[model samples]
Target: MIKSRRKLWLFVGLFFSVIILLTLLVAPSRNQLMSGSTFGVAPDGYAAWYEFMQERNAPIERWQKSFKTLQQNYSDNSITLLRVYGKSAQFAVSKTEREWVKKGNTLVNLAFQGRVTEAPFSTSHETDFGAVKIETTRRNTDSFKAILKDDFGAIIWQEKQSEGKIIYVTTPYLAANAYKLSPGNYDFLANLLESSGGNKILVDEYIHGYKDKETQEIEETSNVFAYLLNTTLLIILIQGLVIVLILIFVYNNTLEKKKI
Candidate 1:
């Protein structure tokens, strides 16, 4: 009986572990294949590109904490790659981050969210990055310089911000899983990063729900009620309460003597 119970518990443990693992493997949203995460394997993921860069000995690293921490710790000239869903106000850069960029950091903004855009004007150009030839579109205004363009507009563009600059790529999936099919993407991205003139490359994974232990602890401590209300923590708490209640009911029903 003891052996059988042990086996059952072990099976349960393994089953739950597998469940958690699978959950972590999936992207946060159906359309977003962990867009900015190097660990993503979906069509829109950067895993392929990240691996390619790593093999070539690129100076790259993943930033899995808040940008505030980044500004505080990194004083040197660095390049950050970021992906935003749209031109909405919610995706606007914060004042502190703008200041960080103004201090001479290059921020590569992958702007598209796997959707088509209606541009006011358009022009086509064949951009040769490395040995790869990409047909791009011109989609920027007088304020922004078009680097590469497609039918929808600029695939890559440049905007000056004091001593630093912000490079915008219309498609977030430029060097995604598709890179396996179109190997030119690897070369294109490699060339882009190399030309950025940064000491290091930082891919922002903090935007993808990844945080260091200290950051997590600090966030939890910042709001007691919010921490208690976390979905995962709430689920665990409820399950534990249910188990305790079941144990109490079983004890009362099976171990107590007859009252009358």
Candidate 2:
């Protein structure tokens, strides 16, 4: 009777463990929650939404690690780089020296912030050109990639920034290659949406000052590994306790029956 009960619970645990292992093998392997280029649209009439990281009193290394962990699950290439301290960091992206150009009313900035820090920058200028088709001159880098579709016609013109970069296909939107699809070839879509604060963001939405902005309860990327480890330890501990309890119960029962 004692052995029978123990076997029942053990079977249940083994069955659930198998289910968990199987699910891990089949789920979409990535933390990226969104995908879609900000192409064919201008950042003029519409105000673009992005999570701004201010002076957050958080460890920068922790944030970088979190970002890296998320990137590892990617099955392909593509990602949005909002630019961190882009003025100096632009050097990692743009290929040419500093220059300027003018749009109808918007001054298109095409200057590199140089790669000293991780941040975004803008030069908003326009040169002697109107509607131009972009040609691939270089790749974004191991860390960045373009996300726009290869649909634009013949090449018309290209702008070289200090950073090794690629051009997104269309306009009227944040250059896709700069934000989502093509440049570095490491492109992925983000779906994190704004939730509470005046500027709220979800999973994929990269917040500007995430570390300093607020206390996050659920860090999906980091939490997964942590949870896996903790849960595994708990399982082992519980199993040991369970087995000890069972042995004691059996011993006690036998002694009681023998005595009776």
Q: Which candidate is the best by lDDT?
A: 1
Model 1 local distance difference test score: 0.64
By TM-score, the best candidate is: 1
Q: How accurate is candidate 2 locally (lDDT)?
A: 0.30
Cα lDDT tens digits, model 1, 57-152, are: 988877878887887888875655554332221255667777788878888876542234465322323447433333223344444676765456
Clashes found in each candidate (C-alpha, N, C closer than 3 A):
4, 69
**Candidate 2 stretches greater than 4 Å from native:** 34-260
Task: Give the per-residue lDDT of model 2 (tens digit) for 174-246.
Answer: 3333332321211111211111011221122232223323335445547767656656555556556656766
Q: In model 1, what is the error at residue 59, expressed in angstroms?
A: 0.5
